[model samples]
Target: MSAGGRGGVRATLSGLTTRGRSFLAAGIAAAVCAYVLGQDDLLRVGLLLAALPLLCAAVLHRTRHRVTAERGLAPARVPATGEARVRLRVDNVSRLPTGLLMLQDRVPYVLGPRPRFVLDRVEPGGHREVSYRVRSDLRGRYRLGPLQVRLSDPFGMCELTRSFSAYDTLTVLPRVEPLPPVRFGGEALGHGDGRQRSLALAGEDDVIPRGYRHGDDLRRVHWRSTAKHGELMVRREEQPRRSRCTVLLDTRAAAYEGAGPGSAFEWAVSGAASVVAHLLERGFSVRLLTDFGVTVSGEGGSGHERAAAAALMMDTLAVIDHSDGADLAGAYDVLRDGHDGLLVAFLGDLDGGQAASVARMRRRGGAVAFVLDPDAWTREPTAVPEPNAPLPQRLRVLREGGWTALGVPRGASLEELWRQADRERPGPAALSGKARG
Candidate 1:
């Protein structure tokens, strides 16, 4: 027999039910006894028994049918604790009808359980679709796929399994909080690193359109221009001086207290995500800077561009991990040359030098910093602090350098802190004023 034929036979035999195996074993014993005793009736019985299992195997091998599976993830992207649906479709394309089919799609433990489904039978050219819901409490890009389909005979004598190689991805983003609008202040933020700029109006000349780019929003299409030009055309994008904001996150493993998902590092990450979402919503072009480097950025003042950029930002944050670097110099480097309109950072513990660097990192624009308190996040709870103690001396340095710095203690509300930073003021006061405990 050919290799394929031999493999088919092996697969056929491997699918044998216990009862089929027992019948085959009994048939072999009966045939041996008959030969020894020279009994015709026993020999006939042995031949009949031996043929039964062989017939079943032949039936299973002869009618090989192909099944196909397709998986779909609804909303493909979701935030932590947000739910999404998964739809699965199976089709039987062969000429012959298929027996019972058991379907199971693999999923990550964080998403809950693996969903299993069953089909009574599939006629020739038949199809079936099933769906399940999955949700996760932590952020990450996870795979849910390679549908496993088990084909079984009605008599339970044989079974075969086929798995689809295709897989679908589901991205779970960090917990994003809807922040209240907050106005900030600093020196006149001259457009330094603007991504979008409005075209200077010269009456009718300014209305002249350009060919649509790949990321251009269809809403901006100028049909009149397209008809005149005999090709697709869109309004000229704004000038490259739109307001910009940089959301920095401290990801150094040694900077935060404790470990795992509950560490101060994770808290900083989530807070940074919230700030990014808020800035984009407020029509500011936003970029995510980390201790490691730039994670992602969103450009343009238009809704379409911001939406696409936001998606990319969240996807990047979903899989972000801690950095081994001991310093937050990456953030400084990313902002060194650019004068961002706003600098919002979620930082972990900082010594005097790093704190000074962070303070000078933003050359111009409104700067807000949330410094995580390492004492509160220690693996073991330490002694409680006095009710009216002042914050760390680094924060004073930050205040002197014109950064709106606040200490993030355990159970602190980010929204409240954001509101506090919104008020613009200089040192020696709480909230909008100088450094306070």
Candidate 2:
């Protein structure tokens, strides 16, 4: 049977508490014998005694006569460490008034303890509204329902309980911060290149003509000018060239060893946020990919920019499992084929096999930058006889394989690392000349 059905049975039996049932049986026996023996006074007394328990049950039931419940201010989606409001409405449908009603609503264990709400008195056909502001400090989905309503008699001899199924679900997303500025090695530091190139409009070059290229906006074609020149020409508009950069936030737990109080995943998220913000501020089209199966493609305009920022913040709170590293490979493959931007990966210490995979990405004609945090390998003091070597040696191996690798110390501020990255990135002039080379 359903819980509500069982609760209904319990409510019916609760009226016959041990004492109540005894008192009822005694009254019935006395009243029947008195009536047969023609004892009017005894019969009257027995009937009066029986009325007590019956009246008590009636009063208990009457108070809970009208009940209406509804959820209030339930957010469609909430972030971890955020709060949501749940509202319950109780209405008195009977002509009598109710006093001191107790209610308990079932909530997920992850949501902590179940809360109780009290209603002083509800007049006949009157309504009472109660609300609880619940806070979720963890990430995941929570189910709420099966409200329990209990009403007590004024004399406190018996209680009436009812159960209802009011199931609702809430999804909690991860809480993230604004993406900060980060630097990565590759083509021009602040110039746009690759698929979507940015051009600066100077007075001397209001409408310079360039050879037609694939993916160029057809609207930008200078039809009159093309006719005059007897060839197709595209209009050149001026905007600061934005570098193309991609950030990979590793979600592997194996990297968290010896990391600070927070998990390595948290640190990686923070690093990715910093890098994305830094690149976006410098006019670099930034894309973010996470091993948690989250992706935000590169966007150019201000609105798209805001979306990317929001995605970064949400990603921080995302739940990730490091059970299999295969997901990392899958995410990397998606990024490799779809994005032509400079690649920056923030990972835990790398193994030989993993280092080979990193090298494979670099060979695909993209500037690859790796930030390896040593904390992952140093969880236990005994785990690192030469813990420090793994990071530097891994970088050397990657560099030898033609990938740009940077070793970031555990606990180092993202701002400092970002500056170091900037120093290592090739300047626009340098890249232009490199193309010639």
Candidate 3:
């Protein structure tokens, strides 16, 4: 539902309690007067109170019909946890003036309380615009609703409410951070790297000649070999094989054991985003496999690259199976068939079984890399070991697996590791030789 459909001034004042409160006070006064005065005074007071409600109701009916409303929200698309401003315009459509009009725009529950404002006066055929800010601290789709306008009689004995349907939808996307450059095998993969691989396949071993085709570079023609063979000869170039990189993300919330701003899952997501961004930038086709049961295939071109990144961001907040002992192996099985590239796993803490799963993945022609968030050990370091801790043993198994493992200590940023990854990337000299060959 739109925000306009939620609570507004009209809705609040229209409540039976509000009207009852005013009527009860007037009744009480009449009762007090009746006790002090004679029966005749009580009868007269009863008529006055009764007539007051009718007179107020009449005034409300007259003024409410004259007011018209329009609603709008600026920058309709906002981040999931951000704020936006809404503008409401109320116009007096009739010749009569509208005085003391209360307006309330229906806001979604996710935005907290509905806002209420007052329109003191709207001259005949005149308009007054009111603006308020709303914040959405959570992610989702919200509808801003029917605008409500309220008018109360001058005597305050009665109230009338009018609602206008002004339908609008707002979509809040997930919050994203600037991902640091990620590297593979100490190689920096970004636009600045001239050594980035292309989709075109070129190698010395392939010598099969094919008929000349349109758009084929003239330098690739084998003129000498063509003349002897008496045919239009062109080099048959194979499509360049991209490095298949699969990001294995652990989505189990139980894996997140630590304190501070960075959780295990948060760090994992950041690392995954950075890695995906770097791979796409360097022309490596990347596929994402998350234990959250989300899979987005590798795509080419800048637009597809963006889609892949957004998919990752979307899955970071997606609901996962919270049941105890939910296996990561299920996610691995889903990605087992098609993944031929390096497998990078980010985990909270490892177990013997989980470690064995990583070993199985490595045996399937996938290079393994592990990012261990040490926050699982302890929020603050102490000499005494905590009970039921498996982090120490997990670290030991990871070290022996021949995997590139990095221990991310509590409060330590990933900037250094990112830089190190960049340093390990292949240099221009290597790329140039590969390209020329």
Best by TM-score: 1
Give candidate 3's root-mean-square deviation (CA, Å). Answer: 9.0
Candidate 3: TM-score? 0.62
lDDT, candidate 1, 1-437, per-residue tens: 00012346787888788978887888888999999999989998998887888787776565444666788889899988899999988777778777788988899998999999989887888988899999998889999877787777776667766666788899989988778876664222323443444464655446768898898899989888888889999877575455778888888877877765576877787898898877776667787889877657787456898788888888888898878988887777778777547788888888878888887775556778899987777735567775554357878878777788899887678898887886644433332333122
Q: How many clashes in each structure?
A: 8, 18, 20
**Where is model 1 more than 4 Å wrong at Cα?**
1-7, 62-65, 186-240, 259-261, 379-383, 386-391, 424-437
Pull out the clashing pairs in model 1. 196-239, 197-238, 197-239, 197-240, 198-239, 427-434, 428-434, 429-434
For candidate 2, the TM-score is 0.66
Best by lDDT: 1
Model 2: lowest-lDDT 10 consecutive positions: 1-10
Error of 2 at 83 (Å): 3.8
What's the CA RMSD for each of the models? Answer: 5.9, 8.0, 9.0
Q: lDDT (0-100) at residue 47 of candidate 2?
A: 87
- How many backbone clashes are present in model 1? 8
lDDT per residue (tens digit) for residues 64-172 in model 2: 4456555555784676678888888877776777756788988886676897987777777787788787667655567777778777655555667777666677766
